[model samples]
Target: MARVLYLGGLGRSGTTLVERLLGELPSVCALGEVVHLWQRDILDDERCGCGARFSACTFWKRVGEQAFNGWGNVDVLRVHALRDLVERTRHIPRLAAGHMPMDEVREYAGFYAKVYNAAAEVSGADVVVDSSKHSALAHVLRWASDVDLRVVHVVRDARGVAYSWTKTVTRPETDGAEEMTRYSPGRSALLWNAHNAAFGLLGRRGVAVRRVRYEEFLTDPRAALIRLADFAGLTLVPDDLNFLRPDHADLGVGHSAAGNPMRFTVGRLPLRRDDAWVAKLPPRQRRMVSAMCGPMLRAYGYPVFTEEA
Candidate 1:
């Protein structure tokens, strides 16, 4: 069983940061959302973390060679279509139960399992950190026969997430062809509620999950990583803790297929909470998010501002 630490949550919730931090560990390999490998990195030939195109990068080329004997055998368009049909958020529960009648999902999961196994073999990693940020996909992988999956359910204050998703940002890898992503406050709130609830259900469904709040993590990252290390059954030595300097991480090239443009970030990283939403977001929008996510927010120890102006 290849150990997989799956980061499950809504987008813009700091999963990428957590994945990158864990990637610093010696025994863990961070594969940035292998789900998007076909479309984003492979077909589009985007920039890798190593600053080379996916196929051109030695690390990913090795991964391709190990996984498929070569990347040529992969049918990008067909696989993309199958993934869209089978990996929808609504399909998560059934997928988690291993009751998927869709042969496409099984086939895809089989392919994904092979990639993860190959990654571990080639990288010599005891664990693989997947910052896919999709509860549905994480659930499906839990039932994979070849992968041992542990989940990190990352939650953030709905207001903060709603604000982040509302802004437009560009990715360096996309050649400005596509913006990062955008969502209405109402939509982000509803999805945030649903995704977090689904991950909680996944834990009850026998998926090993460790819940981490983005706010709490930023407050004390060292403590968070300590808890995460214990949950994932990995060790974190003193050298692996490099939060002191913003340019301290000796990041190496990774064959990550897809994620935020932050994947391109190397050297030192600063840890801080983005609280811009508190002052910048309109009051009505905040109320809407608060109302939609109020109960869950309170349940998770996040404050609700529904009564505010």
Candidate 2:
């Protein structure tokens, strides 16, 4: 069995950064957003984190070979159909309650397990980090018999998340014309609440869950990494994270399949809090997002009434 540290949360909440940092650890292999592996990597053949097309990345080629004999052996359509059936926000309740068809859920999770297991074997990593950021997929993985799943539920302020979604960032993993998805502030706010709340269910369902606030992580990345490493059952010494400095980290290219364009970043990357939302997000929209996510905002230790123009 493979141990998986699943980064579960809403999009734009810093899972990619966390996953990238975790990949710096010798015992961890970061697989970016395996939920999109079929569509983005296998079918579309987008760029991998290693700066090669997915089809050309030797690491993923080996992963495919180890996991399913080869990528060609995978029935991408069948996997996508299974994902659509069981991995959705609507299915989270049934998944948490174990009310969904167990057979179908297990079948879907089996594919993920195979990937994680193969990744661990090929990379010789003790734990594979899947920064999927999908609460629904986290819930679905509860049915994977061979997966030892632990959840790191990353969260950001609702206002920050809403602002991030409104920006037009390019998806560098694809053609220049394809930009990342954007969402209205309201939709981002509601989803921020829903996704974080869904992850809360995992702890109750007996999954090992750790909550990492994006703000706190940026403020003290060393302490954050220490906590995460401990949660993932690894003992970290100072040298294991010497690459992390007070304001930046020395990063190397990885083989993450799909994530924010930040996954493509390497070299000495500065680590700072992105509070541009405070200065740029409209007053009306900020207040609206705060109000929409009031309970969850406070639950996650964010000040709901602190937003200003």
The candidate that achieves the highest TM-score relative to the unseen native structure: 2
Q: Which stretches of candidate 2 lie over 4 Å from their true place?
A: none
Q: Model 1: per-residue lDDT, tens digit, 1-309?
A: 789999989999999888887887778899898887887777888887767888788878887888889888887777777677777789877776666765777676777887888889889999988888887787767657788889999999899899999999998777788898799999999999989998998999887999999988877777788889888898778777754344234455555668887788876566778888888889999988988999999999988864342
Cα shift from native, residue 229, model 2 (Å): 0.4
TM-score of each: 0.93, 0.99
> For residue 1, what is the lDDT in candidate 1?
71
The deviation in Å at residue 197 for candidate 1 is: 1.4
Q: Once model 1 is optimally superposed onto the true structure by TM-score, how far is the C-alpha of residue 183 displaced, in angstroms?
A: 0.9
For 92-188, candidate 2 gives per-residue lDDT tens digits of: 9899999988898999999999999999999999999999988989999988989999999999988999999999999888868699999999999
